[model samples]
Target: MKYLFNLPDFPDSSFVMQITFWTGKQILFKNDALVEQSGEKGKPFLIPDGNGKVVKAYPKPSLPDFAPILIINGEKHRIVAKLPWYQLVLALLPLLLLYGGALGGGAGAIAAMLNMQVFRNEDSAAVKYFKVIGITVAAFAVYFLLVTAIYSVIA
Candidate 1:
């Protein structure tokens, strides 16, 4: 997906970055023009801005806080869409609840993926929160069903 970032010294909405979630490939663009591209996931790309200045961009794929950052003249710029606090808490509920043990961890992983996708989207606040709640309920229901089936089999 393409993420747009506003650099400190640059014009409004000048930086554009694309990061492949699964592959980790990162592409950087300035004002709709391709500046630098990298095939390796999570690898940093250096782009020469202007007047012999260089900008270092990093594609970070860490869970719950997956945001790419650009280092322009020693300052860091985040390239991520912001979500509301309530929505953020709701999205993280599943991962917080079912985070331990093998079966629970599986459910947590699924929920985390869903939450991550929800946060990554550029949708409206209401839609994002709805997705978070919907995904959380769905993950819990699936976890319950799996546990029931396993218990029934053992008994």
Candidate 2:
């Protein structure tokens, strides 16, 4: 996803904008430039402007905390753009429902298939399949344990 925002009071001069993801991935954007570069985790990088001033880039504390600070000539600017937590939860709801549906054997399988379709476009094939299988297995394991407990109680 592309994050777009304006930094009020920022100098009009061209400068580099850097973003470090929670997964240790980095992306760099040049002012009025379209090229992107990867960044290193836990390492500080310089965003130099043509006027000889440099801005420093740092990663946020954890996932969902999209605030990254930019230090321009010793002044700190915290970028406050972030994806809402509800939106993220909504995206993952299908996977959670798929697991819940797994409590029923054949019915669960159908539900899982339907739920998997929701994420078909969001992730790559490998990732999508991996998550689907993983959740299904985990749900089946939980269901088995529940059944075993009930059987023991009845006997």
Whole-model lDDT per candidate:
0.68, 0.48
Write model 2 residue lDDT over 20-90, tens digit each, in one string. 43243555455756433325554555555567775555534333333355544455555544434543443
Model 2 lDDT, residue 101, Cα: 42
Q: Residue 109 CA error for candidate 2 (Å)?
A: 20
RMSD of 2: 10.6
Candidate 2 lDDT for residue 81? 41
Per-residue lDDT tens digits for candidate 1, residues 72-133, read 45666677755567656676778754554677767866686678678767799788778877
Off by over 4 Å in 2: 8-24, 33-41, 65-80, 94-155
Each model's RMSD to truth, in Å? 3.7, 10.6
Clashes of 2: 0
